[model samples]
Target: MSPGDEHDFRGMDQGGRGDDPYSTLGGTRQTRTRLPDGDAGHPHARRPVRNSRSLITITGVVVLLIAAIAFANRGGGNDDTASPTTKNPGAAGSAPTAPTGTKPVQGKNGTIASGFAHDEQGAQSAAANYAVALGSAEMFIAESRQSIIQATHDPAVAQKLQDDLDTAYSPAFYKNVGLNDDGSTPTGLTFVSRTVPVGTKVVKMEKDAATVEVWCTGLVGLAGQGSTKPVTETWFTISQELRWVGDDWKISSSSQAEGPTPVNGDNRASTADEMAAAVDVYGGFTYAR
Candidate 1:
């Protein structure tokens, strides 16, 4: 099956406690103690009475202090305290998903992003963007496929990869997927092929090479009335071996596998026209670490 056919198996009671401490420590007993009525000359005669008003004031102060501390520990809405996933909505995984805040590469080879950094982050960014290009609708078209391969693969393998893809996305393949021989949709239909990276991870990194895996969910099929192959979603992970060449990362080789798929939600399925319109309206992203 094509990459797109992957199975979609895809508040503490501080105030009350403070009062308890005082009460449990014989506070009430102490308050109830009364000096002899006539003991004016006693050594403790000058001491002021500890009233309930005093206890209440002290408890209020303690509660306020506890609350202030809890708020401060929460970082007062600081981004540092935010979960990594929250910080970078596109990034997945448990840790190290925080945004580096590095600007996306300014360079582009045709429509593909390039000029990645020399670090692990850059490798991940390159792998993710390359996955997007490889799974794009453009890959079904000859000229665009060549452009994508040239922009994504290492020079040594670009030609071979292009040739292989040309064979794999043959006219028969296009027809099987409900597209024309040249990768165009039939009249009144929209062909959709898009890969969205859910997260990325660096399996291994070195000075000159890196292996990164991009977990992706994609939409692939024709959207229109009477379509045998209606637009459907698939989940897969693309593992890309990258090389830092000429100040950028290029894919040396890559492989894909079925996903860590999610259970289907209970939402109503949209109509063909609705799906087509949504695809047309929502543009893809240039993924980055």
Candidate 2:
């Protein structure tokens, strides 16, 4: 099968669409409106007070309300479009020549008001990168795991995630990847845990929250010659529901399922030495909108 066939492979990546957990969250309702000004203020205007202090305070309040109204109307419905420059600092720093590759035909993370008018794009970029961080190799180390959980997941769900993954990647898990019974690597071999995303979809998006499904295939193995644990590739899917909290996006919950994987390629398998070399040679990417 073509790589594209396996792109949506497995129950993990192509599990139809999961239910939208926040289908019930309320958002703003846009109704027809006549222009605001000149429509007439309250019939009785305040005594036309000329107190300079009062004038300054009233002006400040009006400016704030205008700002709030602008925020609520952002990320316009359905054909919702937001400025990409605003949400992600990583993207902001990226050279414009960098490619975005393909675009998904479906889904959008709902948009919410970012008080900062320039934050829409940055928020989306952060959400995507945060997803990568959540699915990265660093999550395996205890310290990195804690840091990832704290940085990428909602505080409300971090503890539960820490507990669940601890149980999931137990000694048995380590053993499968050629690690010791305690999840440590033997000398001279490098353990690998990588989640390479084929594509990502934001079924529903918002500036403040998003439901993104990441179609991923991963590599897990110990790369070294004459090693009992040979490197292997596994296909699985990882889904993340993220919420913008404080200033960055955090995962609220996530899950994985087995592949819609296709047959392996006919290319010759690389030697352990070559495999180790490749790992060292290749660098990772920072995915974004």
Q: How well is each residue in 223-252 modelled by candidate 2, as lDDT tens digits? A: 887765555554444545556676556556
TM-score, one value per model: 0.67, 0.55
- lDDT of each residue in 1-289, candidate 1, tens digit only: 2322211210112112222322211012122334344465644333334355433322221122112222222322222343332223235544466777775575888999998888877888898898788777786677987888778877876775555455556566566556778778799888787889998877666677776778878776678787766666556566666788878998765544445567554345778999999989999998888
- Model 1 TM-score (2 dp): 0.67
- Model 2 TM: 0.55
Error of 2 at 166 (Å): 3.3
**lDDT for each candidate structure:** 0.60, 0.45
Index of the highest-lDDT prediction:
1
Best by TM-score: 1
